[model samples]
Target: MANIKLKGSGYGQFGGFTPYGNVTVLAFALATTALGAAAESNSTAAVKNGDVIELGILPTGMRLEDAQVIITTAMTAATTGKLGFVYEDGVDDAAVPQDAAYFINGGSLATAARLRASGTKLVVLPKPAKLVLTVGGADNAKASDIKVLVYGELTGPK
Candidate 1:
């Protein structure tokens, strides 16, 4: 039930875009104890089940086109994660309820592979939101490293 803010969290606005207008690409690298210690425990630790890893922010009007979790180092057996978004205000909007697993839901993290969004669950944000990774199944102490890539486009007026 801990919230882990990774190195690149809240940095989507600074993420570079492709030559084409508003085509955004953001990447985040995560490692075990990369931030050194957790404020809650005051000790270096690994991600645990139910931990919410804030990856970055998606500005309003951005439509999430794709996302990928690349496991650079394998994790513990049965370790899994979900990729999704939450509103910046931390409240769900009734019109478009916040989906905690809108992208890769319950995807495996126990092996070295790239897990990509299925493309069927793309989201067009109504407002600025936080991209997140929710750890599941087991503690990820065995995970050495991982990389997250988020791809999107700004569909709203410039």
Candidate 2:
């Protein structure tokens, strides 16, 4: 296993940790070789409402720490809709996916500007993840590339 440590020193009551004198220590263990290799999964796709795209498949024993979704294409004022991320939990028996076992409710694409949603937590996908969008009345042409980045630990063989 590999480990990274950050050390600094010096602290002033009003200035916080001083760059020169006070001490601050940040350390973390990589845990396993596989975990160190699981940097993140990056998937990009042009998405529309009711469209399902698989982001990635997280190994069975790994734990997803966080996720981020960024709307690469700027949404126009005429574009109005909702975008979401869902991960399969290996339990639903329906032919069609209804309730997302683990989901991150992203911002409405209706915004008149680009959107960046990050730090979504408590998501663990033992299977795979898909993107779901509801583009209410937005112009289909306004839909563009969407990027999903999932961060996690892969403790088992991929």
Candidate 3:
């Protein structure tokens, strides 16, 4: 398994559109080659089961409304993933620990379809945090391309 960190705008904030007053959406996309790379270093390796892909970040005072995974290209059979967040270092709040599968848990990546959160789970970040995707199942290293869309709102006072 590897920890892949997508580089060069492979993932980042989705600009120009706010669903509502303070709501924003973020999008992360990766191809098989990108997913196979090592953390912070894009090497053409192979992703394995249990590989964790560090997607991007969510700012402080942001309420995570929902997350969706879109499989633009189908992955290997049985490949699955879980989307969640982990607070960055120095966060004062401890109420919210890292939830590896807060959004989609063991969701299938074997087919090209849109997968969303299992339930209405809302998380307000006490500080800046890293959004992540943990890949699972056999032959995940063979996955093609996929995208993750995150929706959130700035809860701080304007």
lDDT of 2 by residue, 1-158 (tens): 98988776331223244445322221111111121111222322333344333444444424455444555554434444443434455454343333332334435544434443333444333445444444443333333444555455443323
Q: For candidate 3, lDDT tens digit of each residue in 60-127?
A: 87778898898888777888888988777735456766787888889998899999888565767877
lDDT of 3: 0.75
lDDT of candidate model 2 versus the reference: 0.39
TM-score per candidate, in order?
A: 0.75, 0.42, 0.76
**Global lDDT scores for all candidate models:** 0.75, 0.39, 0.75
lDDT against true structure, model 1: 0.75
**lDDT, candidate 2, residue 75?**
45
**Tens-place lDDT digits, model 1, residues 83-132:** 88899998887766788788789999888999989648566688888888
- Candidate 1 least-lDDT 10 residues: 34-43
Pick by TM-score: 1 or 2, better one:
1
The TM-score-based order of candidates, best leading, equals: 3, 1, 2
